[model samples]
Target: MLDVLAGHAARVRAADPLAGGQDRLPKPGLGEQLVEVPGAVGLASMDRSGLDTLNATWGPLVVHRLHARVGGPDPEAALGALLDAWTAAPRREPGPLAVLWPSRDTAAVRALAVRGFAPTVTVAARPRRPPAGQATDPRVRPATADDLDGIARLYEALVAYDAQFGWVTPRPSTPARIREHLTGTLPRSWAWVAEHDGTVTGVVIVDPPPRSRWIASMVTRMPAAYLGVMYADPAVRGRGVGAALAAAAHARLDAWGVATTLLHHAVANPLSGPFWARQGYRPVHTQWVRQGRPSAR
Candidate 1:
């Protein structure tokens, strides 16, 4: 099984240089279980047992990674067999299951969809180098303690906007949570804001990837910076505020010597897909989701 996964990873990376190699499988911790099929594998955590407990949070997730050998005779049959094995495996608990695969692996994707998996999120990446002729607006600067309120407001606006588009569900205390998150992250992460006429119009937060047991060993060969959150005031949209903020953030990451920066955007987000594309980010991994019971038949 490990050899099969390793071979699949190699082929995926070869098909798309951005799809980085997959070296580490999800190791089961306490109360967790790891399951493997012919061309697919999954790690299931028992923290979530019901639909209500299944949200977008990372903990208590059932994550599956699948790959199919392209150009092989009866590739669909091979994938269907793997999917059957995976779905038939016993689960310690019931919760939302997420399956992720390379966007270029259309065979596996089609099989998953036939089994009821739907596209949820797309993780994209681009070189940290800023494009040529990039100009930083003098008004853009590193965030300060005094800028928390403005940043929080922008974040609140972002959450609300995302909610409107059904991309996220905003909680009642989302504003306060945003404020607290910004307060805690300011000192440790690189955050910047764009100002115009003495008001912040855009914000971008970048951070180095933290050590994690879940990340694949092969994927970590190249260090990456993460674009945690980037939000611009709707009123300031189309005025170059977002571009300026992104350029500044990229310049800083490049100077830090990171090889690449990664971020995920909802494929359904009309605003985000094109905006990030304009920033040179392309999809590497596509996260497909099944909201309810497993549909493996």
Candidate 2:
């Protein structure tokens, strides 16, 4: 089963160079992680002969990693069967089920759509390197403890903007929570804030990607960084605040000898999708979701 999954993963990676080149399977000793569709049990047991998919629960969220068979008999039907089995499977928790696949896997995407999955978030990655030109904005500098309040203000604006797109549910405590979280990240992580006329207008946070069993299995285990948060005041939009902040962050990450940087953004977000693309990030994995009950379309 592991070999079969590795073959599918290789195909997925070959289809897109930026892909992570691995799939997350349920940890060993977990019972019944693999489910074979009716009449496909024998085929599924043979190496590389049948489709392999992984289902796991992360907190309240159920995640399905769909694998498409290369040169399988009816690739679409195979994926559809897997989706049907996954949706009908009993769950220990209730929450949105997210189906993830390589962005280049159109067959699995079509099958997922038929199974009522809708593309939601796109995880993108890019090599860490210095921006082509130095940022002229001297206002963009390493964040200091005194800048916490300003950073929190910028985060509040970011949350408010994202709320418009249903990315966050804002509560009165949201700003305070963000400030507390940023406060903890300040000393250990690299952060920079963009200032305009003595007022911070933007902020970017960089941190080492959290190491997990899932990440350690990737074929290319290079030092990587994560863009934890990058937000600019709406009032400062289109004034190059975000670009300057990102450039500054990239310079720092590059100096740390990071090979790649990754971030996730909502595909439905009009601002984030195009903004990150302009920043040279390319979609590597796409997370499709089905909320509530599955509906055939």
Candidate 3:
């Protein structure tokens, strides 16, 4: 199993150098199953009740998670067999059953697409670069406690805007949950905001390497930072507000000597794909999801 996964990692890293060779495969815990196919192995893990225990903003929670060691010639068959074995049983929840695969590994798409999964989100990454000149707009500035409400409103708008894409759902508790999260992380987190005529119209937040350790293993780079939240008012769209906010964040990240910066965006978001691409971020991993019908068959 370890050898299979290592081979899979090598193939993936060859396609995308930013992909971390998952050298450390921890022992499967309770509710995790190891399933096999012709030339691959898959570990189907359950996160039963996991989402309910986490911050509400950390959602679009998937209960059934499938990880596969599939680098064989028939990548689609390997993955399709694994999915069949994993979803053989009826699920207890209506949440999605998901598989996160390397972005450049297009061979596995047939398996996922045939199984009803859709590429919903991307875990994008970009390596450190020299300072981007200066923020395009001078109105961008660091965030403070007094700016929390404005930030929260912008975040809610972001969620609402994204929910239309069918991946990120807007929950009633999302507003309060985001505010509560920001209240705690804002003091220590690196954040900035854009003001338009004295009203906060945009916000960006990041967790430095120390605070972003929860997801550190996702990449091979050292001292990675997570761009946790970023949103700008609709009125400020097409202005340089978003670009300026990103510039402020990247300048600080480069100064910190961070190796990689990571964030997730909906794959179907017309605005997101182009915006982040312009910022030099490319897809490292994509999360494909089969939603709603997990409980049906």
Candidate 4:
């Protein structure tokens, strides 16, 4: 298990070398502080530089973001302290308190929602199932290296969909970046496209569990997998392409023997919440991320 985490950390380092790059971020105890609790250990990575960046960008908000893995003794105390530190931090404004959790943790996740942190997004997924039917459609196939362009375009669509919130950076979403991510150490990162009469209608990207950071949080050392990042072209919105792609992805994962799969959807996206609900997914967890300057007093 440690080796797997280490490998994942390495891959992430390779992808984003600027974010501590195999030095500060990946090391277990090198973080600013390690708060120990039963069944969990909180690792605070708030270095002076990190804190300074937050203070500058967030304007007087002492943003204390801690990433803790629940594996020690008691996690509740550690989590409590982490949250308390953020809430009590001296901010010019009330700001926001946020935590990202694997959507499978319904109770703990919903608890935060009830504590005034409304859910910003809910990613839902269909657990892996056995391959019951061969993909009769000619559009969907195992993604080959040559299909990188289509995959990138697919990701662009997904990112554009996310841009409505204005949180994503306006960067060049290109094929090279998509290739780096899809071909990286993250296993089962597959893509498929829908073509009809020689024209591409939609695309789907399916990544297995444990490879995904979100899944890694809840499915650690478990015999489960996840499904994520399903997007369809807007031109084919009501043509059943999205459902077909999603169903195919589910069948692929199920054949892989993943106990369950998961993904997140924006609560803000119209009809998204209901669309997944109709597909046998429920509100398993709620995550909130409120961004603002600190109190200006």
Candidate 5:
């Protein structure tokens, strides 16, 4: 397994230097499957069940994830074999099957495409850059516990907008959960809100490196930070509120000497793609998913 992973890592490095060697996988649980595709690179299936609240708020209710070590003479065939084995097996549970592949690995994308997968989200990264060109936007200020109501409101707007893109959804508990989370982290995490005429119009939340360990492995850079949440009200779209909030977040991350600032955005979000691009983030890992009929399981 180590040898196979090493070979795959080498190929990924050649394809995109920005994508670091992140091929290791955790031990699979009871329902997971380790596929055997003879002469194929490697395949490990994951069951992202058992955590209902976490999964529903962040992703599909039940997700079947894949770790495909594709990078050989014929990566497509290898990935195809993994998919064939996966499909032939009876599915006891369902949601969407996701495979996170390097954005630059165009060769492996074919296997996923033919199997009904579409790239829905991208984990983007930006290296350390100079601090904000000017003073922090006067309209953007550090969030306080007092701003919970406003921050939560903008968060709901964000979820509602992103839900239409088919990746995120809101549950009955989502609002309370979000409120609870923000209540706990507002004072500790790097959070900011944009105020237009005294009404909060935008919100930005980035997890400090210490709090970003959950996603740090996705990138090779050290001392990484994760931009967990960001939303701008539709009423204030054309204005620079969103940009101001983002600039504030970037300035904070830069001051911390972060090597990489990472965030995930839905591929279907027409606005997010261009917005994050302008913010200097690019796709390092593209999360491709195959769904059943409608959106969720």
Candidate 6:
């Protein structure tokens, strides 16, 4: 557990050099502490003494720790403290702390802004509903092993679009990779495709979260949620084809009893943000970075 925590700290440091990293926390003897918070699993790797010291010395740490515990009872007070701490800290420096939260958390969103974080990307938490106002003429069906090549082409297009922003670029899409993602028998892990007369026009893929990670984190015993890739031929952009493909993917998840879905979209995408918002999504937590200063753009 300590090793894992150390490794995680190393990753945090690598991603943001200005963050004090593990060195900010009092040394190890602080056995791992895990708590269930409102929107996420709260973990503090240091021990009680370390935590107490942090609360005493750093006003920001005090606010963060208190918020972790009693924020539910007085949300606004906790939020205020968070904002105060954020103001005291310099912007453009990597935060010594990091948190993973559900994208729907309003408090987390506010906290990010307080910490001088910016909305780097947007994640949409879409609920599963029947596809609305669309249909495909040649018809849509589950994508099988045979449709691997077409799926690869669609994934490639999606990844290429992702490259327009940020540093973590996805690999070039390929058939082998598509097959690998769909090999197992698992709920909410499936694919769908639309074909026109003698040609494939659109494709998508859905994958449920893995079981082990949830169990380890004690999130829940329930089956995981789903995410996917989507793409349609440019010629059919406004023709309801993308919506149909999305509806088909949602249908597959619903059949598997997955009602909640999550997906990442570049904040710069013109249509994607409003499209998901119309589908009922709001911002949760964002992945923020500091190039030279602390303000979120």
Model 4 ranges off by over 4 Å = 1-84, 90-96, 101-116, 123-125, 128-131, 172-176, 183-188, 209-214, 219-221, 294-297
* lDDT (C-alpha, whole model) for all candidates: 0.65, 0.64, 0.79, 0.51, 0.80, 0.47
By TM-score, the better pick of 4 and 6 is 4
lDDT by residue for model 6 (1-297), tens: 343334434444444332222322323344444443332223343212222231221112211221122133333344445444433544332322433333433433465566654555654555556644345444567777677667667665665575565422343223344445445432245667788784667876667556323312212223445455677767667776777777776655656665456666766777678766765654533444222222211
Instruction: Give each model a TM-score.
Output: 0.80, 0.79, 0.92, 0.63, 0.93, 0.56
Candidate 3 residue pairs that clash: none
> Which parts of model 2 are misplaced by more than 4 Å?
21-24, 28-32, 38-73, 130-136, 171-173, 209-221, 293-297
What TM-score, to 2 decimals, does candidate 2 have? 0.79
Tens-place lDDT per residue, model 5, 1-297, is: 566576678778888877864565556667566775753443456555333363576676777777777546777787788777776777666677788889987776788899889999999998999775678778899998888999999888888888887877777778888888888887779999988888898999999999988888877887999998999988889788888888898988888899999999999999999999998899999999988656454
Instruction: Compare candidates 1 and 3 on TM-score and give the better one.
Output: 3
For candidate 2, lDDT tens digit of each residue in 70-146?
32445566667767776687765455656656787565468778777888777777676654556457768889999
| lDDT by residue for model 1 (46-128), tens | 33322233132222233433333322334455566666665676765464456667776565567778888788778777765
Model 2: worst 10 consecutive residues (lDDT sum)? 49-58
Number of the top TM-score candidate: 5
Which sections of candidate 6 miss by over 4 Å? 1-111, 128-139, 170-188, 208-223, 280-285, 291-297
Give residue 142's lDDT in candidate 6 (0 to 100). Answer: 74
What does candidate 3 score on TM?
0.92
Which candidate number would show the highest lDDT if scored against the true structure? 5
Model 6 pairs whose backbones collide: 30-47, 91-294, 92-293, 92-294, 103-284
Model 6 / residue 65 / CA error / Å:
16
- Worst lDDT run of 10 residues, candidate 6, spans 58-67
Name every residue pair that clashes in candidate 2: none
